[model samples]
Target: MSTATHTATRMATSTAGHALGDSLTMLRRNLKHALRYPSLTFAVVVTPVMMLLLFNYAYGSTLGAGIGGGHYIDYVTPGIVLMAATSGALVTAIGICTDMTEGIVNRFRTMAISRSAFLAGHVVGSVIQTMIGLVLVVGTALAMGFRPNAGPVEWLAAAGLLLFLTIALTWISAGIGLVAKTVESASNMPMPLQFLPFIGSAIVPTDSMPTALRWFAEYQPFTPMIETLRGLLLGTGIGTSAWIALAWCTALTLVGYFWSRSVFYRR
Candidate 1:
């Protein structure tokens, strides 16, 4: 190889190594914070469990009868899992906002570390935390008599979809955090995302909603995602919902990734 080519290769390798090491360091920092303050994680886990109980006991029988005599728990579990992931993502926003306001970001900027590493760390760590919350919600659902006939492939697909959604939203939450003036605003900004499931196919069929709400619930991202997950886990017909869900997730992930990068660099 030419000397110029060798030099270029060495530069690329060094940059990649630095990025990896910096990201791992930031990941450990975020993980330590999560461990030190356990209440936030506990709150994220508990909210979905509470929702599961409320829906299953209070509204399950009535709603189950309307949905063709199948157990409501089976129908709603997927949505609740998504909800749990969404709830956990809120913490990413708050954490990022806290870092921004506390001057930590400025210190990082002065260092020679990779600029993107901190955000990457938060995104990866948040996804892992969300998965834990999702497992807890799924376990609770199973104890509440939710059952699925999904084979290994189907289960794997469902897990992939959940992880994709978590990453997409966590990126958006990180952007939201960067723009907020304070941690309180950062926390409040993600409130609408958490409530989206309630308006979609999470608790009841979109058709049962009013005509206007039906239109929204049908077209919104959450419904298609929940439908796709239901199809995978319960063997329901996915039809076009799978494509629509994938499109939404991909579009959102790209948009959030770019938006966060732009905002972070501008600050």
Candidate 2:
């Protein structure tokens, strides 16, 4: 390479390293903040656990029969896990909105750190925390007699898919936070997303729903994701649902990230 080219490459590498470092530092900060204030995290973890228990116990008998005598807990755990992740995504918005409203982002703007690191930190940290919460949800489901047929490889793939899904939701929530002028608004904005999966095949089979709702449950983004996750855990046929779910996840991630960045720049 020419000397000029070598110099540019070195500079680019150095900048990328700095950005990663800064992002990690901020990720630690976000995690620490969660540790200090456990209520939000607790709620995020508990809400889905409660839902899982409620659905499995209160309605499991009915729903189990509805799905051809299958174990309701097994059939519903994936959806509940998605709910937990979405609940955690709400925390990302609240954290971001809180920072923005409290002038922390202003302080960040005054610093020399890479601007992207702030969002990256929030997104990454939220994913880590949310994954931890997902584990708790799954454990609870197991305690409730949920049994999955997934082997080690399937479990890993399910974890990977959940991580990707969490990332997508977190980014979109980040954008909502950036756009919201108040923390209340930020919390409210992603509420629909948290519950959207319920409208899918979360509680029961999509085919069992009314015609219009069934069409929506099948065509909406979360149904394929839930189905793909169910397939991974239960050793069922994934078919094209995995591809469709991945496409939705990819599209949401891209849209949320750029949308967050655009709003951040404006602010």
Candidate 3:
């Protein structure tokens, strides 16, 4: 390679190395913040657990533990994990938005920090926290009679998919948090996103819905994610949902990354 080309390559590597280190440090700090504020962290984790218990108790009979055999609880556990991740990312957005509004973000901007690292760190941190919450929820579900037919490897894949969904949505939420003008707007951004699953396979099978709604229920992103997740967890074939889920995750992550970058530049 030419000297100039080699120099450029080295510069790029140096920048990436520095950025990764900064992201890791920021992530550790945020993780510590979560640990210090146990109540807030506990609240985020508990909401989904409460939701699962409520749904199983109140609507368990009506829903009837779903088609694949075990209690609907087993079938629905993946959806519960998605819901928990969604809920957790919503709070993630609000917290980031608050930091931006209160000048914490600006303070970091002035420091010798990688711009992307700031958000990437939080996104990584949220994924870690979401996984912890998932473990707690799964423990509760096991107690409530949910069992996984899939072996450890498949179970890990199921959890991995849930983590992918969490990371993808957390980035989107972070973008919303970064761009939203007020705390209320940032907080509400995830509400509509959270509601998407209600129309998908999360609560009921798409085939069970009316024709029109079923069409929507079948194609929505959350349906595919949930379907793919169910497939992994239950050792069932969810067909196209697996591919579609990956597509949706990729698309959302790209949109959020680019849009949030633009928002940061504008600010």
TM-score, each model? 0.98, 0.97, 0.91
lDDT score, candidate 2, position 238: 82
Q: For candidate 1, write residues 10-34 as lDDT tens digits.
A: 9999999999999999999999999
Model 3 lDDT per residue over 1-267, tens place: 999999999999999999999999999988898888766467667877887898788887678645544477876777877777777767678778888899988789889999878787888887787778878988898899887788888887787788778888888888898878888988788887766787887777788889999999888789899888888888778898888898999998888778877887788
lDDT of each: 0.92, 0.92, 0.81
Q: Which pairs clash inside model 2?
A: none
In model 2, the runs with Cα more than 4 Å from the true position are none
State how far residue 80 of model 3 sits from its true place (Å): 1.3
lDDT of 2: 0.92
- Per-residue lDDT value at 52 in model 3: 87
The residue-by-residue lDDT of candidate 2 on 155-179, one tens digit each, is: 9989999999999999999999988
lDDT of 3 at 109: 84
Best by TM-score: 1
RMSD of 1: 0.8
